[model samples]
Every structure is written in structure tokens, then in C-alpha cells.
Target: MFNKLFGKPKAKGKDAKANVKTVATALSSMERINENLDMLEKKEQILQRKIAAELAKATEYSKAKNKRAAINCLKKKKLFEAQAEQLAAYQLRLHDQMILLEGAKATTDTVDALRSSAVAMKAIQKQTKIDDVDRTMEDISEQQDNMKQIQDALTGPVGVASDFDEDELEAELEELEGTDLDEQLHESMSNVPYAQEPIMSSPEAAVPIPAPSKRTPPEKTPVHDRSEDEELAALQKEMAL
Candidate 1:
């Protein structure tokens, strides 16, 4: 009737919950084990002290030559030795458990450290790439500025003015040379006379002069004077006579 009212009792065995609870319990027990180890170490020390005291009592009994006391002291010594051995075994087990737990903890820490390093390396790589891009942009900007400066120098007003001055100087020099040549020619012309005659005369002016002709005397008139001449001769002869 109760089975019918409550349906059926649940079967209890090891389940997921139970397994989790077991692992939790084991971890709790491990903590207790460490505490117990510390307690056992203290107990071991006490047992070692007891064993030494028993040994001293046995030795004193042996020297006293008392058989019953010596036997009792030997029994006490044996009991102390047995307790010490049990404590030593418990300490050995605790040491093994502690060694295993320490190794597991070290391995877990190492894995975590490696994961952290990998994440840091990824961050560093990203930052380095960004820095490189910024540097490249800066370099390009600097180069552009330098090129602009060079272009300005090539096309500036000073450059044009210098070229203009050179051309003007060349033109002035050519004009000066032309003026000097004209002045020299004028000076030479002024120094020489224009009216000087040629050393050799022309052919027409070189003709020779002709000589003068000879003339004859006029003829004498003799008949008219002959009669006069005879009379004059007769007078002259009479006066002489």
C-alpha cells in the first residue's frame, strides 16, 4: 500500500553527483592528510624521545642486577620502538602524497605561464606592425616635403631674377663693343688728311711739249741805192786828192 502511495523508492548508486561529491571529499581528505602529517611528525618526535628514555631505563636496570625491573624496562622499550615505526610509516605515506600534489601544481602553473606568454607575444606583434605603418607614413611625408622644397628652389623668383641679370649683362657688353669699334674708326679718319695728291699723274697730263720753228731774214733792195752810192764815192775821191 505504501509502495502504491509513494510510487517506487529511487535506487541509490554511484551517479554524477556522487562522483563530484567523491572528488570533493578526496580533496578535503588530502588537506586533512597534510594536517595529519604534521601531527604524525610531532607524534614521531615524542615517540623517539620515549624510546630514548626507555633505553636509559633499561641500561640502568641492567647495571642494578635486578631481573624483574630489567625485563619491565625491556618491554617498555619494545613498545616505544613499535609506536615509532608506525609513525615513520605514516610520515612516508604523507611525503609521497605531498610530492605528487606539488608536481601537479607545478605543471598547472607552467601551462598557465605559457598561455600568458603566447598572448603577450601576439599583442607585441600587433603593436609592432602598427608602429611600422606609422613610421613608413612619417618617412613618406618627410620625403614629400623635401621634394616640394627642391621644386620651389628650381622655380623661385630669385632664380628668374638671376637669369634676367645675366642676359642683360651680355646685351650691354655687346653694345659696348660695338660703340668702341665705331669710336676707333672715327679717331683714325680724323687723324689722316683727305686732299693729298697721287704720286703718279694721269696719262693725258703726261704728253710732251713741242719745240719752236726757225725764221729767214727779209730780202734787201739794191737798185735804188746804187746811184747814190756812186756819187758819194766820187766826192770822197776828190777830197782826198
Candidate 2:
């Protein structure tokens, strides 16, 4: 349904622009591919010529009985054949890409034509709506101005609330100052230094001690009688005379 309304839904302007860029890139790539193909073709022709020359030289050497030279020429011919096969494969790949690029070119041209028609139709519609667009723009500007004024009225500095009570705040500050003064006075009075008292002597310190008394020696008595001792001795002497 949208395709029917929009005339097959032609490519957007941006898509058309991208398609143009892709076409330019594809063209450049095609040119490089053609150059490569030409180089490959030339290489293939050179290899064919070299192969033919080497085969002829090998045949002549073999006829003359130079086996070593003939074998070297055969090796050269094999190398040329291998190179020619590789170039043929490269040519086939280039042909395939050229066919694909041709198809893409046709599709790009068709899309470009459709986009051109769509752009023309869009330009005509824009011109027809010019008056309506101007009126809408004016209405939007008026609404924006009214919105800005309302926002400013709500958010301005003088519109904000005050959080402090002046009289109550002043009384609280005065009470705090009186308390601080009383604390300072009490601290000063308690911190003053006091005088120290001297120690006194007691009466017990003046008393003297008494000396010890002297002791007398004991007397001794005689153990035997002297008169008895003398009578014994006289009787003994008379007997003897």
C-alpha cells in the first residue's frame, strides 16, 4: 500500500547518493580488473611463445645427442606451460567480475532515475506548505516566551523561602554568651594557687636516758683448822726425841 501511494517507493536521496558512490567505486575496480586481464593475456602469449621455442630447441639437441641440454630445454617448456595455465585461470575470474559489474550498472541507472522523480515531487509539496509552516513557527515562538516567564517567576531569588526567625535567633545567641562568661569565671577562681604550711617540732624530742648501777664482788672462807694441824705436829716431834 505504501509503495502504491509513494510511486513504487523510489530510493531515498541518501540511498541514491550512496549508489552513485558505489558506481564510481565499481568503475574504478572494473578498470583495474581490465588492466590485470590485459597483463594476464600478454603473459599467456609470452609463455606460449617460450614453450614453443623451448620444445624446438629440445628436439634439435636430442637429434644431435646432447642429452643434458635437451633435458634442460624440456624443463623450461614445462615451466612455461604451468605459467600459461595460471594466466588462463586469472582471465576467467576477470571475465566473471566484468559481467557482474555490467549488471550492477544497469540497476544503478534505474534507481537513479526513480529517485530523481521522487525528489521533484517532494520539492513541490514543500513549496505548497510554506504559508502553513510560517504560522506554526510564530505560534511556537509565542508559547516559548510565555513558558520562560512562568519559569522565571517560580525560580527567581526573591521568590525563595526564608528559613530563620530574627527575634528567637537573637535570644538564643545571648543565652549562649552568658553561659560562656560564667564558665570562664568559675575556671579562673578554681585555678588560683594556695600558700603551703610549715611543719612543727614536738616535746618528746628533748628527753635524756638514765645510766646503769655498779655491782660488788663476793668473799671467800678457809677450808681447814690451823690449831689442830699444830698439835699433831708437836706430838710427833716429842716421840722422835
Candidate 3:
């Protein structure tokens, strides 16, 4: 374990050595098997040649009218044929062993790979727990919330403006608008002449103003106004000079 983190792992070294040993063993076995197969093949071919030779000899003996010699040659050929058959059987057995070894090697490699993957997955599970993952995600969410709060604090409206009431501001705005409108109205009034003011008429350039119509009961002369007619006749007599 220390070597895995610091340097070369002892387990790896051992596995490599074991792999090399297995490969060497397989290579050596294959070489021996092939060598044996080659020797068996050569031996079988030699036996076949010997059988052919014996057959030719037997034929020659028969042609010479020698029955015993022909029979002996045929017997030798039969023995060589049997030996060749045994060699073929041995070759077949070696081939079967070679095939089995290769299949077993392939199976071993596949199992080892699966075992290694399982170990790695086990190690990863040991390092990363479900509880730890949940805690990490929770921490991330908490940090995000904290950061959002900080950003809001940084960018938010501040001090008096932030605390001001919308109602008060609207009321103040309306007051200012009212004051400005009053000023505009006063300025316009100052620039215009008053339409309701009475205009006095000049006696020399007199305009014959029509009197307003009055109701007879409301305009009846009182006794003092009727007695003024006698004074008006005495004033006209003094003006006759």
C-alpha cells in the first residue's frame, strides 16, 4: 500500500512476475508440444514409407513365385501401419491438449480482468460514501445561497432612499406639482387684465348707458324723493337771472 502511493507497488511486481512465469510456461509447453508433434509426424511418415517399401517387396516376391517372402513383407507392412496409427492418435491428443490450454488461458485472463475491475470499484466505493456525497451537495447549495445573499447585499439600494416611503414620496411630488401649477396660474393672471373690473365713463364723451330694468314695486319713489321735486322747481327759478 505504501509503495502504491510512494513508488512501485510490490503487488504489481508480483503480478507481473506471475504473468511472465505463466507466459513462459505456456510458451515452453507449446514448444514441447510442437516438437513432439513434429517428431510424431516424421515418425508416421517414415512408417508409411517403410510400409510402401514392404508392399513393393511383397509384390516382387509374389511375381517371383515366393509365397513365404510375400507373406513376411505384408506382415511387416501391417506392423508399420499400426505404429503410424498410434502416432496419429498421439498427435490428435497433443492437439486437444494445446486447444484446451489456450482456452483455459483465455478464460483466466478474462476472470483476472473482471476481478481487477471489481477491486477497483470496491476501492472507489470505500473512498466515496453516500453520506459524504450528500454533505458535499448540501455544502455547495449553502455556499450558493450565501453567495446570492452577498450579491444582493452588494447591489441593493441603500440608506435613506431604500428606507423612503412610496406614499410620502408621491405626496411630496404632488405638493411640488401643486406649487408649480399655482405659480404658473398666478403668472398667467398677472399678465391678463381683470374682466370683472368696472370702467368709469367720461361725462364729455358720454356714452348713453342704458339703465337696468327694475321692477315697479322695487323702484317706487319714497316720500323724501317726492318732496325733492319742490326744491328742484325753486332752483330753476333762481337760475332764470
Residue by residue across 1-241, what tens digits does model 1's lDDT show?
2223223212235543554454445455567777899899899899889888878888898899877888898898899889889989988988898677556544544654576578789988987897798999999999999999999988877745666777788999999999999999988755653223232256853423234325432333343354644534443333333
* Maximum-lDDT candidate: 3
Candidate 1: count the clashes. Answer: 0
lDDT of 3 by residue, 13-84 (tens): 677678656755765677688899999999999999999999999999999999999999999999999999
RMSD (Å) of each candidate, 1 decimal: 35.2, 30.5, 19.9
Q: Whole-model lDDT for model 1 versus the true structure?
A: 0.66
> What TM-score goes with each of the models?
0.42, 0.43, 0.50
* Model 3 spans > 4 angstroms off: 1-16, 139-241
lDDT of each: 0.66, 0.72, 0.74
Worst 10 residues of 3 by lDDT: 1-10
Report, for all candidates in order, the number of backbone clashes: 0, 0, 0
Q: What stretches of model 1 exceed 4 Å from their correct place?
A: 1-30, 119-157, 160-241
